[model samples]
Target: MRSLVLCLLTVVAFGSCLKLPSSFKKCDRKRTDFNQCLSDAIYGALKILDKPLPSHGLPSLYDIEFPDEVATIGNRTYGLLQTYYRPRCIGLSKPENINAKLEFGPLTSTLTIEATYSQLTVETGFEAQGTIVLLPVNVVTPFEYTLVNPTYTFTFELEEYEKGTTYFRVIDSKLDMQAHGLKLDYKQLFSNKILNDEFNSAMNVKWREIFALSKSIDEDVFAPLFGTIVNGFLKRVPVADLFDG
Candidate 1:
């Protein structure tokens, strides 16, 4: 999920070209090495983007907060109904290796990125009620999850939109994410110790399947949100203003 927002940030960092931050290095759109230059600029921008930059129309990355959310995943026989409130995320590691590919079309353009992160952690207050393989579950706990070595690939289809100036807006987007490790912990489950242990063990053993089952749900919820955040800044500046001709 950090990857999704950071993907937006990668664009946001550059879109502030009207008054570029000193930390950011601009890339010539016509340069043969534009992609490499963008990758390097994004890496440099991440270090300073954690703090809010009102002049740049970018918010602080450190205190991003989400409103209440309710989502259900899987079939009735094996599904989870989860509700989260005031979820706050932190610990977004810098990307280890990042790549960006840009394609400019006659009417629209595309931006594709592959980013790898060493680690990320999220904490939330949530209530969960569902059935797992026939076992009923009811729990309310502060949830914490840490993901290791997560990688994400996302594509954004952008078109210039009139908002006083010719700014860019995402016409479409696609996101895919995978991780090498996940650690999840919750305080209690079903008011029973054995059930709690068994549930935790089961979740650890089948996280991959669980993640797959919930991937679509996640995309539906997050993709648009990320786009909105990206556009908040992108809409402030014109595409032509962002790059040297």
Candidate 2:
């Protein structure tokens, strides 16, 4: 670990003897200059993140349509539900409190990163028109909702191996849901207004559950996406290319 950290600081050939300019515009993947190139890229990315976000910021839109769905929460079961979600906006602020450590070895490389998000928002239209059997009364309704104030400590480990050609892989990932001041405004289309208000109030009371659900969803969705994106980018591109190019 110590050697890995040291390797990031100085290129082997230039150690204690060379000082490059603060800004290095180009990174050619040369074994002799690998470390410096990696350093320049990493710090440069951080510097870019530190800059103010554009007025539009980053927004992601997703449309989820389910013809039939089934969910068994504890003992209750919701079956044969037609659900749809059109996420109008899913946005996040630039990462804050970025902390990263890298380990480069003879055959493999690993990077662990930790960061926080100051704000995140999601505006969506959701409707699940279905029947939830509850022994005495069967509830059927179309639900719609929105959320905000998403904050969390995101951490992950990325590993790369050089058996034949270096490639990236997501070894592990976790989300620490520090604070999610989630405010949910939801309604059941067929249900009475008073009943919807009561249900929404009850839902708001389960903030912890919301955090837990978000974490689970993040793992299922984002984790695999990261693996795909990273590995795809590094698939044929050798780790050496980052430094040698």
Best by TM-score: 1
- Candidate 2 lDDT over residue span 70-159, tens digit each: 222322244434333433323332444455445665545555444444554444345443444442333444444333444443344557
Question: Which regions of candidate 2 deviate over 4 angstroms?
Answer: 1-89, 105-108, 122-167, 171-174, 187-198, 241-245
TM-score of 2: 0.51
Off by over 4 Å in 1: 1-18, 74-80, 130-136, 162-165, 190-198
- Tell me the lDDT of model 2 at 202: 75
lDDT of 1 by residue, 142-244 (tens): 7766667887676788997764446788888777777887777675755777877776777878878766775676556656655666667677667665676
* Ten contiguous residues with the weakest lDDT in model 2: 55-64
In candidate 1, the residue pairs with backbone N, CA or C atoms under 3 Å apart (3 or more residues apart, or in different chains) clash, namely: none
The worst-scoring run of ten residues by lDDT in candidate 1 lies at 69-78
